[model samples]
Target: MKYPVLFSPIKIGTMEVRNRYVVPPMATGLARADGSPTEGHVAYWAARAKGGYGLLIVEAAAIDPLGKGSPWDEPGIWDDKFIPAWKKVTEEVHKYGAKIAIQLHHAGRQTTHDKIGGQPVAPSPIPCPVEREMPRELTTEEVYDLIEKFGDAARRARDAGFDAVEVHGAHGYLIAQFMSPYSNKRVDEFGGDFMGRMKFPVEIVKNIRRKVGNGYPIIFRLSGDERVPGGRDINDSRLVARVMEEAGVDAIHVSAGVYASTQYIIAPAAVPPGFNVYASEQIKKVVNIPVIAVGRINDPLLAEDILESGKADSVALGRESLADPELPNKVAAGLTEEISPCIGCMQACAGYLFDSTKSNISCLVNPFTGREGELKVEKAEKSKNVMVVGGGPGGLEAAWVAAKRGHKVTLYEKENVLGGQYRIGAIPPTKQDILKAIRYYITMGKKYGVEYKMGVEVTDDLIMKENPDVVILATGGVPLVPNIKGIDNPKFAKAVDILEGKKEAGTNVLIVGGGMVGVETADFLGEHYHNVTIVEMLPEIAKDEQAAVKFFLMERLNKYGVKAITNATVREFLDDGVVYEKGGKEEKLTGFDTIVLAMGAKAYNPLEEKIKGKVSEVYVIGDAIEPRKTLEAIEEAARVAVKI
Candidate 1:
């Protein structure tokens, strides 16, 4: 279990990281709309630090008043009011014996007027691709002002009790826009040649060094490749990394892509693990400063190999950290099975943060993400026996939390095994990572002394016989079968039936629903067996999903050649075909041997009235509250468990 060079301590300027496991700067958009930190922000970072990360760098906080990017929640250091709030975060990390840093940023052309209360001003008058807003080019005097602003932000970060400061010069932001020829099309001294464009970022770093002095660590996040055809590439990154090192940067964090090249930044699943390690290796070879590599560094062994091979000094983990903040700690303690794995499904964290600003940070599998403090399971006043109904993610999490709080907990599941719906998701070729989460909960429940009763249905009489103080109904939802002509026919099958081996799909299959579940089922079938056609009543598949997750799902479905038919209703199921209407035209498609129903699920709330006043405390969570993603179910169950 010896970690390769990943566990080696390395010094960056005056700061020494206990290990090479660095939690890279990733924006969760958990701040208040007015650039203040929220409790969610505190819980998010504290979890990672406590989980044993060597250094946790906060997300990009703008240095200038007008440089804030999105209209949603993102923190800033532009004002003095932010100091005490940031100090709260720093103190929480210090308590865990982990060093923390803040990434200082300027969005430049990437800034949106809605967030900053003014139009964005960049180095040139070029219009942004996504924003479509023309920016007023900055004057030389304004450029100098920007440099000083960055310096002041660095000084404030140190004063705020941060161990280090990171200048966000990557991801096609302000300094990156200046460094990239694709955005900085200016002819002045700050433009024209590569050195001219590089001048601004170097000057910003130099000024930051002058302000923070020689003792403080200052790392530069560099976009190794813009990934846009003619934009910033490795050559440009190398040149800039050397300049940053010469300008007194203590480290270079190599990353890839921008908003323009979406796939590169996010690094789709098709991309290999440690995909961006090449960029960091290139930067590390040329610069004296330490280089950190990110992008799909999910496997601990793989990360260790990258460090041992000298690809970079540190492995920067983002989604992995979000998936399990205690991943490093678990690995260090040789409890690898205890780690909750992040499956690279960005639905809960980045997906919700970008799509819905109001929702707090979440994990697809981990329910206690943002509500860490409020959701802690404290020992019960008196040891009361608890009975949890069902064995899904919600029920399992509730049972585990209650047991941790020293409650005598017992769980009952009608099914022969645990992981209700999650077991189906686990079997799909693309969803192996989800199984890790299910296993983690099961293992934790056993560790916490919870009694598990599988294949046992809990009725009112059964619950009365148990005589528990608290009854948690996590009875999972059932699929809502639409009253279509062929839905109940022998030729048709429910998606769950196919998933659970109750029914088998033929070579040619017609999936009746196009929502997230249906679409995923289609993708699964199409990946292993061809001839899968998805028909939906809605115009778009996965209509309830977040934009980013839907986008990736759509891409995968297309890649698998899963034909999607929307705005269509199923008419009848035939022995050799399916009848559907598209645009008021009746179309009978032949040659499909099977039809799978995947419309959606209905919440099973059978115990509402029965458990309403029967016990001192009654809680309904997961699918019983609402049929939603595993993320919502787990989060709801955890929140309620802590309160109970």
Candidate 2:
């Protein structure tokens, strides 16, 4: 009753999904180098199925060796040997009463030559704007052959016992390449007019229909709006949807953006929730088959609203489900508070996917996401009294986990409220979701019987008084103000002070440092101040930021007209402006009414040294150990707490 529409069953072709929730395909990179599912992949999907998702669409599997999106470690269905591995995944998902689907994919020009053992193939010789890897145009004969390859992948999926299959036609892949005027400039029959561009995907659907038959469900994932100029928009997607439905497709999974606009694909906190619903609504009007809306549809209540408004038939959860596998179950049981919300940080999920060194997907808040089988919280052998210092994310997570493991926990915070510096981090209008993690931690802490002592600073005396078996110091960090002339002037303020509204900026602002904090502060100040300039010693701004996030942040900076000066070192702070050296040349940038110090933070671990020998066991985490990201803080806390 809490979310009737979201919990209700829906039929796609002959298949009946128990709810309107669909886990759209997300690349996990948890497969073997040869593109077979590893035990990690099997356990990952099985966990989601057991958590009560209705329909689970597995990550994209390359249809052929040349179609791989990544160089390695992506599942593939090109060979019969891979069928048994996929069958195990399907069987595991079915055991929990969930229908599973496999996405048959071809990366097209999105891939590199090193990935596919040769030049990547596409509708034309044009390359991706982002990747910039030129692809050879698929020959007319090869185009038809690729369509048959798609059919072959679907037949293998059926033999593997999958309930459905989805064609990966979106996000500037091969099919989308043919559809977009920006990517496909071929004058051949495969590309020219709208219908000509539509020729390849249409033939693909028909071929897949022939292989899977009319009974088996077939979903086509489409980018409702490519979000790039001259690319396919919702209107074009509406036509494609109608064509696919007429071609016997069972459903349409609507997503947005291309590689050039990758931020919209796996949007961060800057993008609002339900970002793709409007496009889905437009596409739904032209098609009879079910339409699934995706992109930052994180909350169950939001999902319900989208369904009740008649925007789409189903709501697909990608990263939200990764944050909490049991999200649907919690919603159905009216235990929504227990569900861990995805903060849209993108640090662990999309950040890792984009990192070639760490391609495995995980969640920032939930450490057990990708390592489902290995990292489990088991009860401690003996319950111990635990004293936790600070009330930030790390301390709260440690306390919650320790309490769940049958430990007596008491968390102390110097401030009246919890969340530590995270409170200030959430002050930005776009970053309000950061506070949701703190709220979830507090809620779960209370449920697990963790005691809280607010306005109580945990000094050495306090720890000795408590005399707990274990002491965890998450004392957090302090703003680092460089020792420079005139730095103590009233015009200079810390970034946190400005964010928290403790200090006000003038018409012109100069922010020192160009890391994530500095760039974000520049974004915040740029909105109010007419002139905002950020100076950093590094060659680039937001060097530590994830690629997709950095891309969007830079776009916002450009939009706001904020001037960024990198490779500049501050020599001194003057009353009106700052003196800096760039490329070994001294320069004076005047006319700044206010200066903000966003130079980052230093660890506040005095208590760790104070209570080191006083406690039987001592641990330092979060900013208390060293100022880092929320992902590192929460993960370190959980890893240490579970062992205790």
For residue 355, model 1's alpha carbon misses the true position, in angstroms, by 3.3
Worst 10 residues of 2 by lDDT: 522-531
What Cα-based lDDT does every candidate model obtain? 0.83, 0.88
lDDT per residue as tens, model 2, 83-111: 89989999999999999999989999999
CA error at residue 68 for candidate 2, angstroms:
1.0
Best by lDDT: 2
TM-score to native of every candidate shown: 0.94, 0.96
Q: Count clashing residue pairs in model 1.
A: 0
Q: Candidate 2: where is the Cα deviation over 4 Å?
A: none
Flag regions of model 1 displaced more than 4 Å. 38-44, 263-272, 357-359, 546-548
- Tens digits of lDDT, candidate 1, 92-211: 889998899999988888867776778899888987787778888999999999999999999989999999998998888899889988888888889999989989988988898898
